[model samples]
Target chain A: MRSSYDVIIVGAGPGGSITAKTCAQAGLEVLLIEKRQEIGDPVRCAEGVGKEGLIHHIEPDSRWIAAELKGSMIFAPDGTEIKMSEEASSQKAGFNLERKIFDRVLAQQAAMAGADVMVKTRATGLLRSNGSISGIKVMYMGEVTEIKASIVIGADGVESKVGRWGGIDTSLKPVDINTCTQFLVSNIDAGEYNKFYIGEKYAPGGYLWLFPKGEHTANLGLGILGSKCGTVRPISLLHKFMETYMPQGKIIEMVVGGVPVSGPIKQTVANGLILVGDAARQSDPLTGGGIINAMDAGKIAGEVCIKAKEKGDYSVKILKEYEDRWRATIGKELSKSLMIKNLLIKVSDEQLNQLAHSLSGIDTSKMALPKVLPILFKKNPKILWELRTLFI
Target chain B: MSVIVNRYKCGYCGACVGVCPAGALELVETWIEVDNTCTSCGVCAKICPVGALVVIK
Candidate 1:
């Protein structure tokens, strides 16, 4: 790789690769780095991305699509199922993805756009000159090397060290992080729609999800509040959940990771550096899904970086524009979703059953997840009184 | 760098120390701790099995 580049992005996941691709396409030299030996190995996510989110970045590739989902079934603790239509589940589109293939395709797009792709390269430290970031020091196959850049994008996930190294406070609270574990199970009977089970018995402070990948394979997972379930491993809980709900299925793959249930970080940009994707806490507070938001941020940041390079100014003041644009577009929805997450955590199993029963008969033809708030208030006027505090 | 393990949330799984590349993390008396000369990479905070370790900003 050259001694320096116009931009260097840490982490070659969907966010970093997309950012690199966009910047390179704009004629800025870009360098993309990944710590893993492979671009998308040891998958950390549930491998499910909504159809609407994927379309915003690029056209859907057939090779990346695992299955097309129609809708979602919400199950109460009492087993009362509320099936929302596909149109209702996604205000736009939906799908289960083959994440490994999808992530690799994104990196390949970046490479094709003229960005230097470096794998097995771990960013060990940030290069600072007089309190300003100039580049990053990386260990490539056990050899330490430094690559300078005009701008650095921290696309690293939930445990992002790049942000911290750049002086951005990206810490998550215990109650705000979801301990997630999943299994890719085969031979499971599931529908075209995804399934979500809610209850303390199944997953406390979170829910269990089943996103069917094919006729016999599905991504089965659950995320629970880390503070509530002590001494119970998330993997063990997932196994118990499968035993209770999908006993006959065979496990094809097991994965564990954390999902930031909090909204975006207070600050996402600093002098010569920007944070994207999970590093910026861009995942949905309710769903713990971030592929779309990450891609959106990547596109915006890429555009901003190009502008900054033209002006020869990589100051925080210039980078702040990206933050303003992203927040103006998706920040409101993320904040609203976080409010819903906090409220959902306070709800008891009995209350969930009651709410599920009350909404079981409602017309979900044009419903959104937030639309259920009004119905929740109608069933229990007390919730309306309590939720008033949230609205204000 | 201080690894603050919320006593209430930590499950003591030792996954944080396991994933640490700098060898700066260790379990002390059932609680995870970070030693001096730490890099503050946030790997422990990221890999903490229970979301217990919050790297103090």
Candidate 2:
């Protein structure tokens, strides 16, 4: 890496790559770095993204699109299955991605857009000048060096250190995190729809998901809340679930990780520094999805950086625009989802079965969640009252 | 040792590093390092999805 550039973005994930691409397209000198030797290896994500949100960034390509889903099925602990058709599902239609390829494609796009991309480059610390952020200290190829930049963007994933080093409070409480594990299983009949199983018996304070990758193969995973994890590990819970539900399936690969269900942090900007993606806690609290959210935040960050460049200012005041813009859009959804997630965890398994039963009668093909929400509210007025923000 | 990491099972996803309240854990590329700041709260051990981190008194 050179000694100086207009911007330095840490992590070449979807968020960082998008930010780099956007900034470079605007003629800003950009440097995007990934600590991994390969830009998208060691994938940790389940790789499901909404079709609508994805098309906004790049067109879906067969090389990376693993499966196109048309609907979803929610299985309550009591074996009550509630089906949702394309229209009923929130994202209408969705795609399960091959993140290994998709992330690299995004980084390649950023590189093609003129951003200098490097792998095996890790940021060690933030370089501060007179109590103000200036740039970053990176270790590239076993050599430590200081690279100066007008603005530094932290697009790092959940293990993000940039935000913390920059003095931003990005801490997550035990209750705010979901400890998760997944397996790539072959010889499974997952069909074409996404499947979800919920209840304390299956995955306490969380749920299990089966996202089909292709014919007879699927990504089966579960995420349990940290506070609810007493003695049973997430992987153990998944094993029990598999033994009972998918005994014939063979596990070929295992992935373990955590998702921030804490919603967005209070401040994502410091003097000459900004945080985006998982670093800013932008992942969805309800579903623990971050891919689309990260891309959205990255887009906004790049746009704000451009405006800041025009004014020759990279101070906290100018950088706050990125936070404000994302808060107005993605942040609003995260807040509501957090409230709903908090309430959902408190619900009993019996109540969930009741919920599924209540919705089983509707013409699911034409029904949207909003259409059935009123009927549900009538049955459970207490939850409806708590979720008032969603209505008004 | 306050915390012991089973690198064999660790996926290096940084889940433990993210939930370390004391900020004592760091993901150094493919492995994780526990620093002196660890409070032995067992939070990292409990939150490690694969049971890779063990906190022993």
Candidate 3:
């Protein structure tokens, strides 16, 4: 690998790949490195994203789309199933991806866009020059090497070290982080609907999910509030869930990771560096969804980084524009999601059942959080005083 | 050489299972099991998010 480049993107996940593709297409020397020997093996994501937002950025590829979703069902502890059909699924109509293949295709796209991609190459630490971030020190094939860049994009993920190394405050409180576990099971009837289960029993301070991949196959997963998981572990809870629901199913794959679900961090950029995807805590606080958001952040960072490159100045001033642009896209929604998530956790199971039962008939597909209260308050206007912020 | 997981401390996020180069580690509902195929390269222990997996060389 060359010892230097115009841009160095750490992590070849969707976010990093998108940034690399955009930047390389703009005619910059880009190097994208991944720690894994393979680009997308040992996938950690559940791989559900909105078609509207994602299709707006990239074309659909059948090789990676595991299942085309038509709708979603949210199950409350009391067995109330709130269905949002495709016609009404404004924000949820999308696809369940074979992330192992999906993530690979993205990195391949980056390579096709003229970015040099490397696997099994780990960024050991950040490289510095003149007291500012420049590139990264990488280890590959048992050798340590320094690579310089005009800008570095860290899409490293939930426990992102890039931000901390580059002086950005990326620390997430336990309450903001969701510890997740996923299992790919076969020989089960998953149907086409993506399902989400809420209640402390299924997921303490979090939720459980089933993203169907194909006929009789599904990705079963759950995320628990990091702070709330004291003696309770995700596996124990998931085991019980499976025993109760899919006792005959067989697990084919398993993964574990954390999703930053509170909101964007205080800052995602610093001199000569930018953070995107989970690194910036860009995942939705309500659903812990981030595939599309990461791609959006990547596109913005790619464009802004190109501008910074041409100007020959990679200061925080220029990099801050990336943050501003990112925030403009999904900042408010994420903040609101965080608020809703916090409030939901405080809600009793009875309230969730009531809320689910109330909206189970709504014709709305997207079912935006703000619209929930008007219907909810109509049924029980007495508690509206305390939970008024949810409507706002 | 092999990998071991302390079930009590293990959050069972499957980080070790995901990183195991040999595909010898699997997280069953009860615990993380290290099978006969394990080469014990220690990648699992290194990548354990909760520091539950330990490698005894």
For model 2, how does the per-residue alpha-carbon lDDT over B1-57 read when each residue is reduced to its tens digit?
479999898889898888877778888788998889888999888788888888977
Candidate 2's docking class is medium
Off by over 4 Å in 3: A86-92, A364-373, A377-392, B1-57
Tens-place lDDT per residue, model 3, A1-392, is 68789999998888999999999999999999987688777777788877887786778988999998877888899888876654453544779998888898899999999999988887768988886798999888878889999898998876566777787766555677777778898999998889999988688788999999989999999888766754666666777899999999899877777777868678888888999898888999988899888898999999998999899889988888998888887887798777768777888788778777777557646563345557776776554445566565
Per-candidate TM-score against the hidden true structure: 0.87, 0.96, 0.86
User: Mind giving the per-residue lDDT tens digits that candidate 1 earns over A238-270?
Assistant: 888888777899998876667777786689998
Candidate maximizing DockQ: 2
lDDT of 2 by residue, A1-392 (tens): 47899899999999999999999999999999898888887788788887888999999999999898887777999988777654544544789999999999999999999999888999989898866788899988899999988889998888888988888867678788888999999998978788889999888888999999988988999999988875888899999989988899999988888899998679999888989898889999988899999999999999988988899989878988898899999999899789888988999998888777876666665454555566677677764578765766
Chain B TM-score (model 1 vs. true structure): 0.76
Off by over 4 Å in 1: A86-92, A384-392, B1-57
> What order do candidates take by TM-score, descending?
2, 1, 3
**lDDT on C-alpha atoms for all candidate structures:** 0.79, 0.87, 0.79
Would you list the clashing residue pairs of candidate 3?
Answer: A88-A365, A89-A365, A256-B13
Q: How good is chain A of candidate 2, measured by TM-score?
A: 0.96
Judged by lDDT, which candidate is best? 2
Indicate the worst ten consecutive residues by lDDT in candidate 3 chain A: A83-92
lDDT of 1 at A98: 87
